[model samples]
Target: GTYPLYDITASPLTSGTHKFDGPEKNNPYRVLGIDEKQNYARFRFSGERNKRKLNVEFLGIKGEKLGEWSISENDLKTPKQ
Candidate 1:
């Protein structure tokens, strides 16, 4: 499975929404929004048949990885509080 490439290095650290096409054509991943002040981000994946693992990484300004985690499909199905 493949994932879309998103580079935000040059972008300002401001809250905003984004959209990107998934690896498969017609499938899209929507970034609902990012709250810089709250340090939170929300996204939606619209690929039902995609069984690939979703790995998230947090990087510092210098591009050093601060932390990382993997989100399973089951986790995505859980309702938000």
Candidate 2:
């Protein structure tokens, strides 16, 4: 499956909420806000039928990699109520 590549670090991100445009035009999943003080970030994913896993990387202020992880499709699925 082909996934759209996003250049998230095109501009310096501050320590607060933010909203930006995605790689695809008119994309709804466009929020990629990261709050350093709160140690959390928010982003939405557009479901891909053939995607089995997603890889995420965390970077510091100086562009150093803090950590990395992979999310399996199973873990991304909503649990049954």
Candidate 3:
């Protein structure tokens, strides 16, 4: 029972004179790709600046999420492919 594995990498944010562009809305991103481990999924968020987030879900063979871990922005160190 495994869903898939993947990674979400975002490009660097541009320099500006602001603490934050705006509140990071809990935007739902589409599943971009899967990893070889079959335990994670990648998603991309399109906003003012490019952003990416990874979701690790424990699947139940039929591809269902039983548990998950949301990746933080710091975890991404490179641009997604």
Per-candidate TM equals: 0.33, 0.35, 0.28
For all candidates in order, the CA lDDT equals 0.42, 0.48, 0.39
**Higher-scoring candidate on lDDT, 1 or 3:** 1
lDDT of 1: 0.42
- Of 2 and 3, the candidate ahead on TM-score is 2
Model 3, 1-81: lDDT tens digits are: 333444443222232222212332322453322222234232434334435554554443345653555754545555455
Which model, 1 or 2, shows the larger TM-score?
2
- lDDT tens digits, residues 1-81, model 1? 344354322233353534434553243552322223223222333435755456555444455654444555655453555
**lDDT accuracy of residue 15 in candidate 3:** 21
* Clashes within 3 Å, all models in order: 0, 0, 7
lDDT (tens digit, per residue) of candidate 2 on 24-81 = 4355654434334223222335457756665665565666655554555766455666
lDDT of 3 at 27: 29
TM-score of 1: 0.33
Give the Å shift of residue 72 in candidate 1. Answer: 1.1
After superposition, the stretches of candidate 2 with alpha carbons farther than 4 Å from their true spots are: 1-12, 16-51, 78-81
List the lowest-lDDT window of 10 residues for candidate 1: 33-42
